[model samples]
Target chain A: MLARLNVALLGLLASTLSFAGDAISATEKQPLNLHAIGMFVLFVSMTLGITYWAAGRTKSASDFYTAGGGITGFQNGLAIAGDYMSAATLLGLTALVYTKGVDGYIYMIAFFAGWPIILFLMAERLRNLGKFTFADITSYRLNQSKVRTMAAVSSLTVVCFYLVAQMVGAGQLIKLLFGLDYNIALFVVGALMMVYVTFGGMVATTWVQIIKACMLLAGGTLVAVLAMSQFGFSFEKMMGQAVSLHSLGEKLLFPGTLLPDPITALSLGLGLMFGTAGLPHILMRFFTVTNAKEARKSVLYASGFVAYFFNVILLMGFAAIIIVGQNPEFFEGGQIGGKIVGGGNMIAMHLAKAVGGNLLLGFLSAVAFATILAVVSGLALAGAAAISHDIYARVIRKGKATETEELRVSRFASVGLGLVAIVLGIAFEKMNVAFMVALAFGIAASANFPVLILSMYWKGLTTRGAVAGGYAGLVAAVLLVVFSKSVWVTVLGNAEALFPYDQPALFSMPLAFLITFIVSKLDNSAEAQAERAAFEDQYVRAQTGFGAAEASSH
Target chain B: MSTTASQNAVYARIRKNPRFAELVSKRQGFATLLSIIVLVIFYGFFMVVAFNPNLIGQRLSEGSYVTIGIAAELFMFIFFWVLTAVYVKRANGEFDEITAEIVRDASKEVK
Candidate 1:
């Protein structure tokens, strides 16, 4: 059966690759960008060296999953920032700001708001309770097999959706930036991701992320400083120029120009906030630290870096309006106000070239590609943990799996997930897959966030209630996304969407919470009583870290 | 198994410690308050955008080119980071001290 599935996946890849080849050649051939390719090759070589070093030390399951839990707070914080800031944030967000003006900043504010809440409520408890995956916490006192199965399924779902989105975005962005073929880009990304995760495990993944974060920070600072220098480093002067040059003029500085309605605004805000907390990859970073102190520090550093980058993007976006938007060289056929050369997302790249020439542009392009690889590696690691730790070790083996066996399973799972991601990225190349990110966030918020949070805080939560509520949220989120306008009308060729809102968090998240609360209140089983009785033990450990997993010494 | 039993005993004793109770309650209160502050600030901005966006779009002064919205967002970007720093300082220093004391006491009781 597995072989058959592999054959099918390969067949699909071949068909998609043939069509994509034709499609690419039909368009005007982009000249090969030697500078960008050279920078990216240097980055790949450095990360592979780190992976070789990390592979030597990856000796056990703990090392594979959480890097022996030996990472310091500051290093973990940088890694977390790397995981959160994907290529989308660098490119898509800048594009949003370039086109929509201040509306992009508003979107960014919603995204950054989640970090403080995670620190305040979830970080310490998560560090204290979880050992490897977030499932370790949710299934702590519940029926291990049942609750873990649900958690693993939901986690894998979130991981797969997020991975596909990153893979597709990586393919398209690399093609545009480095003039690399889409298939070749996907293959390189998938192969490197598998190598990093299957060999170096979380140790290599964390280092890669930290390195990428620094490079991204440095690159962004250069672009922002160089571009802002043109405006005399004056925000008022930049905004005034942007306002005069932009089509929207005065309205570009406001919020109403972005979100069409109140419900969508609130829903998008809530999804981005809680979704950060619920993401399996982001949640997994807490365990890489030593303790709650490190976890909290990580969140603080992550939030600071993320917010600071947004401020940088704010400058780059406005600068691009003047720098890239006004320059005919960056636009197609030297049309100054018409479509951009490589599309809207290339505004930041164009601005880089306009300010610092080809050197900065090549550097930023490499950074963008590195950002995607780091994020996908994190996601793949999280997915592997869900499979090997939650499902295989805890559920299937019934806690009987040895460390070596679990480690073997994790490597295999990482390779499997990497292959699946590549295939899906290629197959979905011609389709509109931007909504997958939103859907992933919706599922994370509705399915994973509610159960994980409740298990930590509420004593009344039972196995049945959690499984039921989690599945409900998962199903509702997927169903709503399918029926929403983006998928229902645009992708599926339907006449009208059944769901009015593009974001399902406003409706589905509440439904999940209400169902979980009501179901737990109604449950009166003896097992429910036992789970409630066990909460005190979990509560104490969560509060003080008395019996929490200690960092393993080498 | 015996280690797990002793661990549970220590956890039970820690749960009963007055300091543990104090730590949980104090931390919980602070966390809840901070979460509320963040939510209100973020969602409040959303509400304004939904209902009265022009208010935020208005300039800071007659001469300044910066809008009230951008100024407010810039303030929030820095202010939110400060809030996290504040929570971290208290939680890592004061609350952690209490936690360490409670755990030490509870382990002694179990022994």
Candidate 2:
């Protein structure tokens, strides 16, 4: 079975290469239009203006970090969509479904399934506890310094991985859509994202995300509608055509079955579902809402919007499969004759170009660019907040710093983080964006999620426990991922990898939880009785959102 | 400590109000149970798919004739919305009341 799967994959690869060659030769003379560039500029300008307008209202650290906690449910809903729906969702999933059939929907299922966990468990508590960062919650009962250090490290790690992925994606999208060099695209996207985040903070970043989400959904839906219309509004016919042409069989709907093993299937599922809850960028959005209820509402809205958008993307992918398959000339030839042009990420863009001409193509391309920018900006902000607010003000300075000073440091951190991302993006431009994303998710799940879950529910959870658990998860996940086949072979170009593990969830997550549990048991009496009482009071306050209101009333 | 106990009493009173208690108890259980069922059914379906990939594979080429795959996908979408609607409703009613009670209790403690 393994040999057969390998042979089949190789065959598919050969066909894909040929398709790429054909596509490149056929579209070699097709130049990018200035009209697309004009539309791109107009869209960018509008989003930037909104961001700038919002930034003007940001007068304090709270405003800079959480938009003064004034974002409406509807507005925050759109921003949530913007933040969660990245270039990967817009393009990669569409392309995957286009090429691989049902396997593509795995991404959608995993992404959406994680929301319930967020809604029921994380969102409200997160909103009520820490003002901005995950560190706030984990470090609540523990020593603030230990919490800050672990939280910052985790946030930075996730943000760096996520930013690099978005940057790499931006480079690819620019090359495909604008016919520009990958390096130029990466540089342009990096600069734009840095400016938007550094200048506007959460306020600007939120609006930019909202605009990007709207465009991606609209653009993706339009293509799906067009594709369905071509099939006389029949999804069944589209699937039929896909299955007939591709012979995807059960693998179309049940992902990893195509991989010749159940372990791979489970790994993919775990990665998608658990990874969503742990993503730093996604988790940070909980802090943007005013209250726990609003936070819950935001998740509901985000889930609904994301599910709807993904359905449209699913249709778009099926459309591409049928449409592109019907016309083999559409395939770009590389080392083989049947492979599609670019990687799996280019399917949606190619579909737009196929159906809507260069104008639609350009529009979608610009939306893709916006998608990368919005995601990276949010990531940069999270990284900055973790450093400035969580570490510097709360931990290092021991809450002595003024709000003004904190805001200054946060803005500076944003700039620094953005520059770091730009450099990394340029450096790793050739790597797969999805791998970077997966690595971030792995780290987040192993390190942050355990710390978050344990701290919120476990009253006995001590500072030592959190630190031990957090660092353990962080180190274990990073080490496992670095040694995994995907990173070692794919990213580092080393065939002989040390560790056989591809997914770190089965090991690192449990290890982190175990370490935390043991440490908490040992440090049970370390916290003073008075401090323990105060901490219990804080937990109730955090859970109820009464803490802040009670403080203000006093 | 006595002040905190008194505050807790008032909170318990607010929580124990017949209408509020009934609503809170019913909705909280309902939400929790519904969420569990949704997650179970969602994962259960995936588990089935994992174990039996051929369940929907045969219907792939059936073409607009209401195949199992299409039905399953539609069911999943509907299930998702049902869960969302349940959450929104319960959040507005039971969860909101509990939060209000807690807020009131905390405020009294401050006084």
Candidate 3:
């Protein structure tokens, strides 16, 4: 789910420039692609059937929260893969390789790099600690009411930014793929996501993710295999072709295409690498497994699938440059039209047709839409957890809320979140997906990550430190982004940016850590002492899984 | 579990267990080493890019045509994955054995 927002970021930018309006109008004039619609229909029927089965089985809060800890390692791995691959990935990363060349590989590497840290430091501990939301771990031993409130706000902030990016990207993507109007596309995705979250909960969400992962893996491999047939399966020959055809020539094989600025590169790197550990939706997936060991195993499986998937897509991107770049059929005036029909992001889709014809195009288009659906469901579920489980149940009710009542509120929140997403989706329809997601990751890394990591590893963290430090990071990230080049100059049409740097994580992350440390050191009150003293047990629970919550059998 | 005081005592008690000490040291030692390796490899790329972004485009060997940076990144990617596999393998085969032993010894004392 988080992975695909990477899809929206570049897909819209590149695709929108090439034949954005013309394709939208053409798709409107013609009926939707029948084969693509048929496959989508079949996938929908199967998933809804699974949701029906899951709804009947989802009885208790644990069932809704963690799927009763029933998912196998392989299945959880697939689910994590599903959540990891998003519309942004499908459309954006491919386009980056097709256009930017070697620099685009930075994103692919950064995305995978985080999983190892998660594997080594957080995954086993998280599975042992958090039940429904990652916020659970952040507030595990702190002053529950205050810390959980901060967690809920931080979680909701990240989810909203991510959800809007997905919704907007989906709205534009379906318009080009299915020829459906943007509003209709948004409504269909929003409604379906609500159904999966409200009725099926985590059970339905996990199944959808698993299904999408398999489909994506199958679809990506087919494209790569076909592309390889051109070069007799020679990786070296393929790279040479991309380098020769690329406008940058040999330079295309090097790094620094996206963010060449040293400070910005460092900042963006920090954000993407650490941000995965704190994303509410991704962390919540750990709870679906039976134990910490299973959690470790799942990351192992996910890393393999993700590594294979990105590597194959990287190959296909290079292939697109060779296959699609020379075809003036995909260009306007003998050059890729940034505002025409097939310029930037659609290069991969066009290359699919160039290599495998219409059948592959239909299959890929269907996979793209399915990825958006799987991603939105995961985000919606996480958002509802923050609202119903963290805010309404823990903070407001002061831990007196009933399980049934929390579950009911969770379903209700999903529907509400869907409505909000629809409105924001339309509002940001023309916004760049990459910037939206960067905002999400930046806040996640600075605000959510700092507080959670310090709380888990540091012994002196207090309630005030967590709340104060978290809000400081959150405000810094958002405020810096608002005044930075990506948004301030480009979108807002300002002459100059208030913030010289685009990424805030480099500054904001340290600020949050520093504030938390200083405030914690000075805190010697009775409550602060207790919270600090509680860390020794929390450390043991996190490490050995001795007193961690057990899998429910009901 | 419900009260803060009781939870604090739980950790203090576990701290006294020799097995818990063994589990923490061995696991954290290996983890810190792995984390340093991953960070160095990733940040090493960032530092190179930060100083000389164009250095990445330099030809790998006199006439191969593939950039050195590309080859380095692919190597880093594969190496990072291998490191993770190695860590999980050890954690399951060795670290986990220690964890189980620690939990077993500590549980009796807590009760």
Candidate 4:
């Protein structure tokens, strides 16, 4: 299985290598948006400088994977917030709220809820358990090779889907912001991400995320503040203006006006609450801190930042409706007769422009571009870790691979992952990328979250159970998502969806939990008993930070 | 109960320590409770969204522009963050010190 998978991956990589720097449709045909482009270039060059410095310092696998465990709690907080916000949360969520109104708040809250869950249950234990990748913790007491393989597959799947979603979002938003073609925007972002990961690794990725987080927070807050001042600093007056000025009127202020269905709402709740914890890129962050203590601190800081950011995002949504919605300059034709300029995703930028004018518009556009690059860099680094640290070093080499060899393979993996992201991003260019990101979160919730949480808490979990449960979840989520209304009916042009609902977690999450429980209960094998007996030690270590991987002092 | 480990067997001795039992129960119980509280808040709101969309969509008051849904979820969101801070503060202050003590006593006995 391992050899065959390796061959398949290598084949995929080889095919991609030829197309690495290929053309991205025709971008030059479009008129240049000088302000956005200039700011984007300025931001890119600054990040490139950081990447060069990080490249010189990144020496060992620890440095490549977890930034040598040297990240402070506050910095990790910013980076984690950076990873979570993405263009989807910033521009996409803003658009959703602008269009959907009250329904949008539910989605943002669900996204933020994952942080508290992580802090309460997973963060400290993961820091005390894993080394670089989350697979380290999951495979610790179970059958190492088997668990690693299972974890690597799930981790890669989550990262790849997340990568495509972020890339597609980057493409569409850049086109809107910069007047560039979709394909060109994707290609540029993908290439920039590849440079960051291939050159600077985790150290560079973390700093980029931190800087992006601060910028996003500052920009989001300013937009909200300016919008609020319009109504004499009264939220009620602002909301009144939002309802009255919005295309939908008072309906826009109501929840069901956008999301009327309860089933989809319940299912989406499942995806956001659990999926945020399961994302490999997010989970891998726990190891970047020195100990369980720092891990907790990081989550605390992250929770605060995420909550604050979302509060501002909620305000941005209403602001768009009140301020951006009223201004005829933002419409597609620069008048009220046409649709909002660049569709809904551009509303936040339009709001920035309306409140802050061209100078603020340039700054916000640059910040949004930085948002996409920072997120993709983090995703690529996680994918590389799964391939190199988990699959290559632990599984293929039987834990005997040299540090130099591992680091080299990791760089190659980063480039391979970046290329794949560009291709997938272009393919999904026209899709609603916010929905695509939701699907990614759903997959993580069902497949990875169950396995990781159970491994930590349940002594009954065995290799058979973990593998069976994980694969069951991975298959169910992928299948259900493909058949759901979003894909089957919408993307695939089917007359009707094979699945009744868009969110799969209502069915898939429970099924995963049930299967894992039943399988572990029935497995009476000697190895199963041993794995069960070994749980006490794993639990002790998870709780007390005993036998944890030491943070290297860089 | 030697200080030298026979592979995974080092932890087997600590398992018998009274302190070990106490630490595990306290920490696990605390985590379980925190998780349940969050789940209830999240899923409870979810239930409302799932079952009664109109309930949340209603205005906070007759004249207010803010909907009950917005007000309620915001309360829950801020509350959840507070709960996390509460858990982290307690664990780092109370739990970590207990963990260190438990590990120390268990190791001393084994040595």
How close is every model to the real structure, measured as TM-score? 0.96, 0.88, 0.93, 0.93
TM-score, B chain, candidate 4? 0.85
Proportion of native contacts found in each model?
0.81, 0.21, 0.65, 0.75
Report the candidate with higher TM-score, 3 versus 4: 3
Ranking by lDDT: 1, 3, 4, 2
Candidate 4's residue-wise lDDT over A58-97, tens digit each?
9999999999998888889899999888887888789888
DockQ of each: 0.74, 0.29, 0.62, 0.58
Question: Which model scores highest in lDDT?
Answer: 1
lDDT of 3 by residue, A47-110 (tens): 8778888999999988998899878788999999999889788778888988888877877888
Name the regions of candidate 3 deviating beyond 4 angstroms: A1-31, A332-343, B1-13, B109-111
Give the C-alpha miss distance for residue A417 in model 1, angstroms: 0.6
Using lDDT as the yardstick, the better of models 1 and 4 is 1
Native interface contact recovery, model 4? 0.75
**Docking band of candidate 3:** medium
Write one digit per residue (lDDT tens) for candidate 2, span A1-554. 32343344345334433344333553432244455556776776676667667667777777778777777667788898899988888887887787677766755776777777677666667777767777877776667787778888988998898888888777767666655556555656766676677778888998898888888888888877877888889766776676666656435654443334455555555666667777777887777777767777887788888889988988888888767655655666532226666655677877887788878888888888788888888888899998899888987788999998998899889888877877887888656655677678778888888888887777767777888988998999888888987888877899787876577776788899899888777764637343355455555555456543111110
Docking class of 4: medium
Residue A452 shift from truth in candidate 3, angstroms? 0.8
lDDT of 3 at A217: 92
Question: lDDT tens digits, residues A196-299, model 1?
Answer: 89989999999999999999999999999999999899988998899899988877877754688899899999999998989999999999989999999999
